[model samples]
Target: MILMSPAEPGRKFIDSPAMTQGHGTVSLKSRNRNSRQLLSSSEDEQYQKERVVSPEIMCSLKSRIANKQNVANVTRNQLSTSHILDASANMTISKEKEERIRRQKEKQEEFRKHLIAKQQNNVSVDNTKNYCDDTALLTRRDLTNTDENSLLTEDSDLLLNTTKPSNNKSVIIVDSREINGAQDIVSTLRFNHDINVVAAQLDSCDYVVSVRMGVDRKQWSEFSNGTNRAKMTERLLEMCDFYERPCLIIEKDKCKPEEKGRILHWTKYVDKTLVHLIQSKMTLFFTENQLETASIVADLCQLENRKNCAISCPINLNTDQQNRVKFYRSIPHLSYVHCLFLCNNYKTVASFLCSDVKTIMTNGKMTEERASNVYNYIRRTFDTQMLPSNYG
Candidate 1:
């Protein structure tokens, strides 16, 4: 109803709009300002609370971060160490495998050598008159005295019968490799000529005639062929190095009657080779057949016996002794016989080196020329600057 007049600041009214107001009067502008101020103050107080932090809390947080990093580093280190260990283990395993393989190979080699020796013994037993005769030759370890009489293993009768002296029954040492190819020669030497044909493992020759002489038998075809010439030359040259008298027996190829006329004739190459061989100081003998070759061999054996140049008893040298022999063999014009003599006389390389030229000549059974050569060779000065570029 009644429209009341606006109340004055100092007046009081009952049931009026002014009666609902508080004792203090306020402007709308000021009230709005106050509300805005309260909101701003509350926001500032919340932001301060959020920003404030304790030193202990900050340190703990930092420590947690550091601990995580340390843990990561430790894990990385462990992984690296494990990898290294694995690599070392693999290396050790590989080394062990290599060692095992090497031992196996060595065993195999030793076994192979044993088999070869056994086979050689069996063959010698079956072919020779007495097993002990040949075995004694191999078993005699004392090479200090190389007397021919002491070395002879045959029954004294076989060697010293007045009717059939040692000269009449000559001994020829044939290479084991030649057994298959030269069966006829072996048979003829044994049965026909009554010669003691002993098989051995000869490195440089098919037949060892004496301590000084060795023979290599070659067929005419091998001698004439261009392909085989180089190999044959090298072999013959090696033989020359091994023996004082290296002989090559060129046997005519046994062809059928129809093929006899078609046999290859000696070419210029053959003549050239022959000239080269002669120049090398190698002896050559031509034979019509194996029978004739056996006769020639028998004749050679008899001649060597007469000259007291019989073959020495074969001995199985150990590795070191064999190497020593090889070193001795390297000397120019030194024969295998002389090499064996040197080895037999000297127990050690030092003793051999200490010996004078005279002692070397006596012990090695070498001529003055050969002994001088060996002595000079041992004492020869080796100057690297004076050597050719290709020199080994």
Candidate 2:
């Protein structure tokens, strides 16, 4: 207790070992408990701080999430719209293709139907011909030996009987010699009036007739205007109009190779003249085979009321030869008939058919077999009975 050595202010000294140990243990436990409680309090404070957020930061996060969701929605909608447009375009293309195919099928069907109808008509005509042939054997009568001349005379008389006089005193003047072999056609007509046939080359006339046989390339080139054939044609047309003459232009059906074998009008090479004439009907145009030219000329002459004397001719024939004579006589009579049958141009065909059979045969250079074939073909092709009785 004496402060002899005041042991460094209040230093404690253990009196008993058990007491010291119990006190130390208690102090250590208390310190550990205090450290645990402090740690738990700090952790709770940290958790609370982490949980709390600023209002601005919360709004920004929400906006960012909302923007992401909107972007996703927009992208999905664009993809859907693009798919829809693609599908619509494909559908439209498909529809057009289908429509075109359908139209083509329809045209093909129509053509097939037309072919079938044509075939049926041909069959019907054949059946009718057979029926007529069977009936003719029983009712056919014997006929006199009438020559071609007699038949021609009869036809002329028949035509004269039916012709009505016209006030228009139009005369058809011709330059028969100008066209090669065309004189034969004019001579065959045997016009009642004084034929104004001239050997001189004429500039303009009522009728300008020309004939072409086969493909004449040089002649075609000459007419194709190296020297202005179109201008010449125009001038001719104008002259005819001024003179108050009916213009008849006759050309052969044959043309040059360049023309593709089509029987074009003479004025076709003349540019606008053809269209003008057609629209005005100022000129008569004819494109016929060389063989048919005589028939056309004869028809025109007969229509003009030209008088021709009938020639009476009789050929001596036996009972067996009577039919042959009749058949020969029928050839000339069918001139006008065949003309009308072939082209339906009554005047032109009549004039052509009225040509002398001998002249036609010579001009055409046709053999008997070929002529018969042509005649038979025409009779088979057209409804011959539909023609006037006189023509038939």
Candidate 3:
């Protein structure tokens, strides 16, 4: 309030005012800059957190997508495998169907052939009846009416007594397959004729007639009577026992003329398999199919004066003939064909037997003694033109 040096005091007060105003303005500016820096830093931190969360979400999505893709690939693979399996199964089914169709076709063909045969036979019978009827129409009634029954009876008696076998002379027809009941075929003739049937192991009959089908090119049986193999293979035991004679051996097969060795046939095409059984040792009436050599042997057997003759082909004797030959047939567990291969050789007859002996002995569990006995006996019979003495 004192007016002492007014200019100096006024100047100092004015300078203080100016300095305070400037400081206040500077402080407000500094505070504004600090607030802006804090806000910018907070925005940068939020941006960083957003970047981290975005990457995490993206990675999780990518991983899930990859898993889905892998699952799709696995499903495709499984589908492919299933397709392959189904295709293979279809192929197997197709093959079975083809086989069945083939069999059915064959059966139909056979049935057709049988029908044709029957038709032809019926036509032949009708023609025969027509001819007989024509003959009756041409004949006079008085001639036909007189003593018809008596004349028929007389002719039948004459026919029955006329077809007698040769006296003590035996004719045998050696064949492959055993005929069924040969005795039945000729027994009526024997009963009406003056013939005696011997009960011995080896009996002789007159004029034996034989027939066979599908005989092998070079095979013969070495079995004797009363043996197990012989019993099984000999389907026509009545013929062998009572026929007591050689019969004609008529074989059925379309064998080539140039082919060598004897023909073979077996009974029981699917089962039992009785095969290559020799019916007799007398004569062989070969089909036009056998070779010259076989035909020659058949001729030798057919000679009227001949007593006993071996088959055209060499025979095997060491092994049980029935066992070895029959085994290859339809018989179960009896066929050693898998073990021992086929033998069509026709050497001294023993070659077939000797070569197959080892297998036979092993299969039959036969002793050397038993085998030797068989061998010696078979050799003797083959060499001596006699039935095996062993046949009781």
Candidate 4:
């Protein structure tokens, strides 16, 4: 039997004689080792030629890369500088705008001051004439009634007695500071409205109509002034602390005779202040003139008087009694009047604690509900679980 073997890889097939059963066969053949080495050496030489780079070409490639890098760096620097220049330009423009606005405000304020000064100057002459006329009437009335000795005695009385006689009329306490600005209103209240207008140094408000009512009067110009805005807010808030029914009265602005300018529209600041006052639940009233404002004040005084809320001057209290009043005032929902009543009736916190709810109502003149709340606050047993978790 004749058998043939498979040819090996990377070798040429050649006819060869084999001593296997005296048969001829085809087998793989390989080249001589020296010839293979020569061929490999020649191929390496050609590869080296292809892979190797010339110095000139190398320098050229490096120069091209360097040029690209320089261009990129120049572009980045230009972009950064442009951004910086734009930022500086914007800053300068904003500064210019702010300066222009500040200058405009300054000019407006100066003009307003000048106008106010002019109006005051004009009004001064008229006020002087009116004062002289009032003095003349007073002299005529005083001269007819007494001798020099009696007149001398009554002069001191006249100077001391500035308040008008009430004659069963409602009384209104006017702040001394308001005398200069609201002389016309005061005169109107005294003579026309027949209100007992008493001028006193009131710290909390310009006018007090009742035990729980206060009024702060402001002219349009004063209310709208930027400088007085904070002062007005502070005054109103302080009034709120003192009175249950605090009111703000805005009177019309008085101008010079020839001045034709008027506030046709409110400013944004004015609108914002109005919104804030509304949110605070402040009572606001507007009047066209001094007479109208006086009428409004008179109406408030009469209304409160009808309601039996007439202002009661605080009675003198010793330090102990005063402390008692303070303690009573700390009770929830109790008014100053109710606190005074409690202080006067109970005389001590221990006594107040021992009283029943009905006794509290009788002594403090409080409603049943209010008396019950006080009784519960004083006598209720405290429980550990009833306390807030954060207390622990």
Candidate 5:
């Protein structure tokens, strides 16, 4: 009967055991809450200690935290974008600069090609470079009858000691119709003075010969027409560049009936335009003088036969030229800088100084020490204290 007894479904069973299990769970929860409270108090104490630190130290710590946040933000978002944007800006500027340089180089190259084409056209070329203080005329040169090679000679360096002859230099020449006895004129120009002839080999000399095209009264007049002959003058100057050089036309037969008249008209037209274009371009000489005219002028300025002279600053000078030479001689000489300018408007003084200047250029570039010696000799020879202000 005791074994058969079963517990009812709703009956309270093991009351002590239930209490023990519930008590264990409640104790665990209380222990967790106490641990949380301890952690919160520890955090508060650390915050108070930080507040007691100096402003400098607190600011530094805040900055460090902010910097760390910034780093995180940058790493998470725009790191690649900022790098790409900076690179793009630098590349854009570099591209713009490259484009500008390319355009300038293109223009220079194109101009050079144009000049080379003219040279190939059998035109006599002459490159005249003037260096001096006339600042105005220093860039211009009027060719007369003289051998350019002779002027370039060391002992015959009559005009300049620093002559920078460019391989791509330009030349100027005349184109005149054949006149009576044109062969004689050509021979005179060629033999008497060293004028370039296109028929001559390019390897032998640097020049392009431009043969006179035509001589007709009406055409010459047409070219020479307009106010102050402005239009005609421009055309004539341009005609020089056609062949881009000038040479005498040696005709075996007599000139055409209208040739002389046309030639005469052309000469007058050019004479009218001479003063205007002289600064930028164009050199003029009488048509009758022939092509040798330019060479002759070159020779006169060059000290071909003059002996080299030595000059020095003397304690006592007997001549006025001595003083002028000493003044210019006192200055130091630069290696690349040459072409002397003795500027004075007075005629007599200019003439005397010019003679001395000629002597100085007779020798090539010399050391600064030699200038004094050369100037002294010039002073002794010319006896003037001033130099010429005007020379073509």
Candidate 6:
């Protein structure tokens, strides 16, 4: 055995050759065997050192591993909690968006409905204006004719052509309690020379009937002590039953009842009374409520006649009447002119112009010469200007 010094750190140990080696050369097999023995010893020593650990170091290692595992678990839990929070936040945002959208849709729907109603109201007003214009044109044409006698005959013939001749005389039943000088107005009309007008008290007349002027709340209350409105109504109906041609005139203002449905209820009552009376020749009229002037009352009385000529002439041709006619005629002419310019109705336009001119002549507003000139001028304008280019 040869003595060997302890190897230095990080240095490999080298074996010295023994004196028995031949020619100072080591055998390859022997060297390989020695190297293997050295390597085995080192491996055994490393294994023993690894197996012989202290209790404190082992416990420290175990604690360190446990801490690492706890940290990993905490990280996983935090990630899961963050994911849940993100999901809840996303849901809240989505709900808010949905709510806002719903509100926006509702607002749009409301605006649409309001727009439609406004348009309908505008259309109704326009239609009414057009109708008034047409009626006015007809009246003006009749008034402005040059040949009064011929026009009058023509109007009579036209009227007669539409209706069969009747022998029934014009009889008006006068209500005893007329208001606002209505009685005096009716009295004047009764004496007029134009028509064979006959007037009788409400109780005596069968065809035409007029109610007292003060049918308002105070008058109605005083008439029957506010006990029964139907009582006065019943009395009026009974008076109307005796006539062959029954006509009922009610004051426009006084016909209203205090309660909403009372008027409707009263109307039903009147209707029922009429049905019971079995009178087929019944006519109803609602006149102006409050008449301040006698002329107004006279005008109303004229309107009461079945003939259109009844109210055509003003009671007195004062500035007021002239102004009224001019104002009334002017509005319709404006509308008619507008219609003429836009519409292609030459024959109808010519007839309307002729009729208005005739009416003006009959009313003594225009001379025959002036009426004729107006008729010709309007007719020429209608033919030349208002007519369509294609229309002959």
Best by lDDT: 1
Per-residue lDDT for 254-325 in model 4, tens only?
Answer: 767676465544788788988888888578999888989999999998888777566432334679977897
* TM-score for all models, in order of appearance: 0.49, 0.26, 0.25, 0.41, 0.18, 0.28
What residue runs in model 2 are displaced by over 4 Å at the alpha carbon? 1-20, 48-60, 83-87, 90-98, 121-392
Candidate 1's C-alpha runs over 4 A off are 1-169, 198-201, 261-263, 278-280, 312-333, 381-392
Order candidates by TM-score, high to low. Answer: 1, 4, 6, 2, 3, 5
Q: Candidate 4 clashing pairs? A: none
lDDT of each: 0.74, 0.44, 0.41, 0.71, 0.40, 0.43
The C-alpha RMSD in Å for every predicted model, in order, reads: 15.8, 21.0, 23.0, 24.2, 24.1, 24.0
What global local distance difference test value does model 2 have?
0.44
Off by over 4 Å in 6: 1-39, 47-61, 135-139, 145-392
Error of 3 at 43 (Å): 7.1
lDDT of 6 by residue, 1-392 (tens): 75545665322223224434542455767788899999999899999988999999999999999999999999999999999999999999899989988988888888888889888987687556544654464566557643544555455212111111132223333344442335544555455422223332233222221111111111222332335556655655443332223444444334545553444224554556547435544454444443322233344334544433221211223454344334323422121111212122212323444465654333333244544554565556434576577855
lDDT tens digits by residue: candidate 5, 1-392: 32323655333342458877887899999999998999898889889877788989889999999999999988867977888887998899899999989998999999999989988653333222223422222233224313423323333213331222233221112223322323444455445554432221111111222111111112233434555465444444433432222222211223576665543434654564445545533443333333444344333222221221111111122356345534543443311111112211212334434443333332323332444545665556553557676766
What tens digits encode model 2's per-residue C-alpha lDDT throughout 1-392?
A: 74535665433445357768988999999999999999999999999988999899999999999999999999999999988988998898889889989998999999999999998998687556544642342233113223533433444312211111122222233443435645554554335333333232233442422211011111233344436756655655544332222344445445567877665435545556446556653455454443355455445544434332111111122464444333333443222112212221112333434554432322222334434544554345667788788844
Per-residue alpha-carbon lDDT of candidate 3 for residues 67-139, written as tens digits (9 for 90 to 100): 9999999999999999999999999999999999999999999999999999999868755654464345324
lDDT of 1 at 143: 58
lDDT score for residue 362 of model 2: 23
Show how many residue pairs clash in every candidate, following the order shown: 0, 8, 21, 0, 28, 19
Stretches of candidate 5 off by over 4 Å are 1-185, 194-196, 200-275, 278-281, 287-392
TM-score of 5: 0.18
